[model samples]
Target: MSSKINAALGREIRDSLREMRIQLSTLNHRVGSRLGLKDADLDCLDLINRAGPISPGALARRAGLHPATVTGILDRLERGGWVARERDPADRRAVVVRPVQERAADVLHLYAGMNRGIARICADYDEAELRVVADFLRRTAEAGRQATEEL
Candidate 1:
């Protein structure tokens, strides 16, 4: 591509990414409000749910949260019935967090509209296009992670 075209595309991509970030942040806040939880609490719940019974220390590392902060987040989640803490069988002294599946349906329902929108948008893409989009998203997410680490 010509330099002019490349620059224009870069500007457009950056603009879109900024807009997406703002929208996602708003959506997350709305979901958190619906569940009566803070964003950090919801983030911890999501991390625990995806990781499947992870140790608190591990969650803190993954989430870039202080262990003390994680403790408070877990306390709130536990109280809200969004997560449960259990003794790790392999290491009796260690505790692992698990998602409270029964409560997950309500949270999932809150995301249904967005999920449907994403599905509709994805339906317009063929396999090749989806692969490209997936690759772009994965790389973009990694870049975001790296940027956060710098801060």
Candidate 2:
């Protein structure tokens, strides 16, 4: 493809990705509200679950939240039975946050429709095409993380 065409495609893809992110965030807010949790709390739970038993400080750093704010988020999550704080084995004085497995499925239920759609779309791609799509998504996700860090 010509460089001009490639550049235009890139711009279009970036804009679409931005809009998709905004829509996803809006969906998450609605789901969070339905679950009786703030969007930030669900975001915190997601970060904690992905990290798999992370230090409060580390979670706060990744979430771009203050320690005090993280504390409040954790408090609410714990009270809702969505997460728990366990003393870090490596550092007895420190606590690590983890998701409650039972409640995790409830969160996943909110994304079931999207997940099914994504799976159906992926079914149209062969192995090689799927690999390309996966690679593109991984690189795009990294770019998003970099952009978030910059902000």
Candidate 3:
């Protein structure tokens, strides 16, 4: 009986996660449109911003995109003034991509509403409960990364 209850709870959690993913994807799409970026372009930009300065090859690997595709996205982003390509200090011959801080600020501004909403929701949870929620989200994200690698 306990095993059955656990399985049911697991399924419920998975379903909820799927719904959240869909909503987030939709939000990203809207944000990308506002920024005059394609979904792929915005996704690559987000990765670059989070990873800090990264080589094009490394960005391609992290984004799971072909090198040529990454090159095109970088070209578009560069032209849009969203990112800058500069020489990697460690390897003078290599190039690294970095987000234009001013542009990143614009992106963050668009997300302000969502961030506030999440903060309000988090306020309802105590530290212990929030810690459990954070742990679950972190593990779930890791599982997703593993699954993507497997694919």
Candidate 4:
């Protein structure tokens, strides 16, 4: 009975995750379409913007993507003049990927708009109501960390 209960709970969790992803994805698609960038491309741009100049492999690790996938994304951004790869001066052997002039404002604005949109949405709710959602997500993420630690 306990095993069955656990199995049922697992399925419920899976369904909930799927629903959350679908809704979140729909929102991102709407935003990304307005901005004209691919989902994968956004992750790549964000890594450079957030992590400073990092090698392709390091960027992939930071973004939780494979190197080949990151390479393809960079290719698009490079061709669009949105990103540039430069040789690491200290490590002369390594090439670091970074956003060049063309993409800087666009890349930064993407995150800024999302934050502003979220803030605007949160404004509709009372502070107490917003706090519950924030606390729940934090706890859920912490629980995920604990689960991963056990493995």
Candidate 5:
């Protein structure tokens, strides 16, 4: 691609990413409300679910929240029956947070529509194209993490 074309493509990609972020934030807000969770609490829950048995400190760092804030979120989540804090088997002194499997289905149900839409969108692309898109998304996510850390 020519430099001019590449520049235009970059601009378009940036705009598309911004729009996607806004839409995802809105969706998260709705989901969080339905689950009786604050947006930050829901985000922490997601990080915990995906990371599987993570320490409070690790979750705070991953979620870009302070340790105290994470503790508060954990308290709410526990009271809401969304997650559990258990002693780490490897290190009895430490604690690890895990999602309560029984409630996982509720969260999944809320996101099912979006997941199906994403799957349908992916169906339009060939394997190679899908690979390219996946690679781009991974790189972009890493870039976002780095940017967040820098702030």
Candidate 6:
């Protein structure tokens, strides 16, 4: 009886996880479109948010975009007033691009919810088990990124 119940719960969890991922992805597409972001804008922002105060050329390289494309994205971002470019004080010829707000407050709220939700899901796991799960996910993501590079 106990074994059957556990197996059923496991299946439920797996299906629910898949459904939630799909829902979140669809929601992201909808919300991003509403916000006037291109399908690729999220990746561009993520790259900039991770390593900003950098130049358009460098941002293009890191985001796997052409320099001209990066310039276009930057122009849109600047027009939206979400980003700013300033001449590097040291070089006076170099430009720095940075987010106007570091992890915007609304964005932080969403992060908090996501963090708590994931923590709650893993609350049953011990630290060692959690470590293994985290490592596995990281490795899986790395494999995915590598596969993209190969294409």
RMSD of each: 1.0, 1.2, 1.0, 5.3, 0.7, 5.4
Give the per-residue lDDT of model 5 (tens digit) for 70-113: 99999999999999999999999999999999999999999999
Candidate 5 segments exceeding 4 Å error: none
Candidate ranking (lDDT, best to worst) = 5, 3, 1, 2, 4, 6
lDDT of 6: 0.76
Residue 41 CA displacement from its true place in model 1, Å: 0.7
The true-versus-predicted C-alpha distance at residue 131 of model 3, in Å, is 1.2
TM-score of every model versus the real structure: 0.96, 0.94, 0.97, 0.61, 0.98, 0.69
Q: After superposing candidate 3 on the true structure, give the runs of residues whose Cα lies further than 4 Å from its correct spot.
A: none
Give the per-residue lDDT digits (tens) of candidate 6, residues 23-104: 7777667655766777566567657777888888888877778898988888887887667899987789899888778435
lDDT of 2 at 72: 97
- Badly placed stretches (over 4 Å) of model 6 are 1-24, 110-113
Q: What is the lDDT of residue 130 in candidate 5?
A: 99
For all candidates in order, the CA lDDT equals 0.93, 0.92, 0.95, 0.79, 0.96, 0.76
lDDT of 1 by residue, 1-151 (tens): 8999999999999999999999988999999998899999888888998996999999999899999999999999998888889999999999999999999898899999999999999999999999999999999999988999999
TM-score of 1: 0.96
Which portions of model 2 miss their true places by more than 4 Å? none
TM-score of 2: 0.94
lDDT of 4 by residue, 30-62 (tens): 655766778777667767877867899988876
